[model samples]
Target: MDLSTPPPDLYGRPRADTFFRFLTAFGDRYSPALGGPLLRRNPRRPFSRPTEALQLVVTARRRVAADVVELTLADPSGGPLPGWQPGAHLRLTLPSGRERHYSLCGDPADPADQADPAGSAERSGYRIAVRRLPDGGGGSAEIHDTLHPGTRLTARRPRNGFAFCAEPAVLFLAGGIGITPLLPMVREARRNGLDWHLVHTGRSADTLPFAAELRALDPARVHLRTDDEHGGPPTGTELLAHAPRGAAVYCCGPAPMLTAVQRALDASPAASLHFERFGAAPVTDGEPFTVRLGADGPELPVPADRSALDVLREARPDLPYSCKQGFCGTCEVRLLAGAPDHRDRRLTPERRADGALLPCVSRAAAGETLVLDL
Candidate 1:
């Protein structure tokens, strides 16, 4: 660990000192926090034991696009599954015990869409789409190659990090499988009779998932752009050229696409952007620190370029974590000692004050030791 000087001034990672201040200013500008709709009237449908483990059976599976497979998970006894809204994701534990989080693409209102071909009206399932990532960790590959009908998997209830909010106009930009979370959001926006548009882009039409469904919803409002058809990839500015002024923009895609969209937002301040990345944000401006597990447990050193979760896992490999990005609360632990340089978007001010921190993307200041409830 380097103790030579202070940390780098990375614009990407939020600094602990200014995070709460930024949050208040951001809420004032955005009108509502990114958690969800501020004007929702209907109560969330009843759900039992949201955080408990559920054994779900795969009732149906099919290829929706070139590398994407849509899987329908249902209760074995045909009971109602937990209710969720747009932007919610499921924590799936694969047969090999590797955990992965996938956005809930299917409509929560119609949980068992076509799962019961026999025309049963039971709201017995949830749907998710997975794009096989050969270069990524093995979760996607396992789902693509090994999982099939009748396969049972362990999963946690839905959790929403990239929630859709109420607005007069909405603009959605999706890249490849990043469309999963936005799918339900688009549906909700349209159902509410709100003005909305979608710009779906991918390598080609063959690689874009749910193209037919999108067009079937509204042909004129959906713009499907492909790199092959458009000569090459488009600039972030080009993507927003046709967006409505003062629209709420929701985006999910490759990091380059997101970075481009963020850059475009800088030039076009009329639109407010809310985005969810496919993977963890790259750590930047991090300073090395120490973490002492529990009271007398080992003190582990977290390098400047790495996360505390990554280092702690070496000592406790079974340490639970779903999304390494810190959006999900799976890796959160009690902050027993030291001031944390909080970087996660999941924790609220109340939770932080209650002594909780997500180690996945957060750390301690230089020369300080963060004692966690391992």
Candidate 2:
């Protein structure tokens, strides 16, 4: 670790210190400070927990567009789910029995949404933006076709996989549905009076929600790029035009957009680029191996052809999983001893280097005797 400066987080990873301060306010309660009767040991990790389940009751639902559904979920058990920071997401049991993970797009500090009775429930509830997927028989479709107001579901408590940094300003890039998780981070940055810019893209303006909000922000701070604008094509070049140096660029769109951003960021340092994905991916460089679960101590065969999730389920059916695509950290395991070859898209390289493994896509790189947390 470089001693030239203070280390970021415990991972020696770079982090915007203020982000941690903000996270401390969210469901991250500890004794002697946010004094409560509840005894605690885990001390409420923001982006650090494997998973925390919540009972979510859909209080409101609105069709923001043809494919997009905006939903408000509150306490199904009438209690606070957990503390969450911006860029947090929850995986849950949707109305169709299909599990899906949706980013929490609400302000973490908004007391109106807080689960505390003394705190406000008006703005404290979690908001999820779900767009109907053409092939997603699991998440998007269930939220679109089956869910409505009064629908109750079980969800993993909010966990922030994507975190903001303290860089001078931020450049947020959103593609298609990738815009959901980014909304809160943008709002927080703007509210904090941070100097940041946003480059939003979609098929057309009509397909993009928050057009009015984006425009309301100073024109210098926001730019909209639509592929099918009436004036002409949105000019794919416009997407690259806003690439600013020294500014952290976050992209959340389709694979094409992500690829474009990846290539664009190649021109800059790796730390300035961040992106999110909601698709299938192979565990790169994986080889067939065996995993030893801590509880049962059973030897399960994991093949190069099989996903770690698939092998684990066959060995331990009761294992928790949501958004098997790796967005939710429910299946995250602690690497008691092993060189984990991480392939998930959720964690930063520094954190992944710290020995956490998401069984959904990550696998063992060393020998056998992989000890798991659950």
Candidate 3:
């Protein structure tokens, strides 16, 4: 069967009935009276343990751009840090107890390879850049104002939801600080000698982080377009014009730019596009609903102003959750029944069809009651 094509009985009433019949026949043929081992399945689903939080100290902090700051975090005990691939992000627990996620922008190669043999060569560190969001949430402000060298912080092991695709060629489009996750991907592409091009845009040259570093990487392949110098931002038509046929387009940027890129890629049949959003998923106009955790559990009221995860956590505080913005899949639960509004960006159309829901941001239809596996 073609991997891209869905099976005829992939999802529907027919599939469920067929599965039920198969299970019944199998049980009848392999009974305990036949002297064979009884077929018993585990009741609980296997789940991978969560990544442990690392105690890291800020070793260096520098302003890389007008509002962007680069922070270097190292293990306080001087040990090797966890390895991470391109497009990975670290969830940081701030001093105020607020959890925030930031992408790793530095090189993924072992730092020990280039360090002196006697000077903690085996120890590795992570470099992350953050842009101050004055009018937005307080996480960025906390990092900018209070975090400094010698300050200790806790962060989870790196996890990646956005990953690089293996393609013959790639086109990278970054807007402002969105370039953080794509930085390592560009380096890897260059190291592998892949055909790659980068288009970076910002309000002004001063606002674009890593401007000098990106220019030095490959001036021929890197295109910088600033609103001040170009009269306006580069249009999607101009960006795609440089993308060759069959190339994979990876974009991480402001919502407006991403929306425009999506529209442009929709018109292009030769190139495939992937996106990573730095902000929360677009909110929907939803009404209050009810969520039943288990068959015998009490129904919880989910208010329109609150999330299902928040409501459920009030009663059951052990529920797993991280990055409440819905980008991470930590809070995903099996949907036993109900029509989900499905607002999460992590779940694909096919996965949503498979009865999975991200409770952190997803909701049920108005007046609908959802039954969850929790």
Q: For each candidate, what is the lDDT? A: 0.82, 0.68, 0.79
Residue 119 of candidate 3: its Cα lDDT?
A: 40
> What is candidate 2's CA lDDT for residue 105?
74
lDDT of 1 by residue, 253-309 (tens): 999999999988867634699999988777778899999999898899999899998
How much does candidate 1 score in TM-score? 0.74
lDDT of 2 by residue, 1-374 (tens): 12233324322134556677676554344435446574333355435554455678888987765588889888865666555666777777766555667887767666666656465423347888888878544467667777788888887655555766535567888876677888877877777777678888788877786667666866788887777764643333456556555677777777666766666565553346776776655455667877877746877778876777778877777666676676556677777666666767678676676767888887765455566765
Pairs in steric clash, model 2: 27-83, 52-157, 112-120, 112-123, 112-124, 113-123, 113-124, 113-125, 114-124
Per-residue lDDT of candidate 3, residues 88-200 (tens digit)? 78888877776778998987653443233454323378899999998755788989999999999998877777767546698999999999999988987887778888999
TM-score of each: 0.74, 0.65, 0.71
Off by over 4 Å in 1: 1-51, 110-122, 290-303, 311-320, 332-339, 345-357, 369-374
Best by lDDT: 1
Best by TM-score: 1
- Give residue 187's lDDT in candidate 3 (0 to 100): 87
User: Which candidate do you rate higher for TM-score, 2 or 3?
Assistant: 3
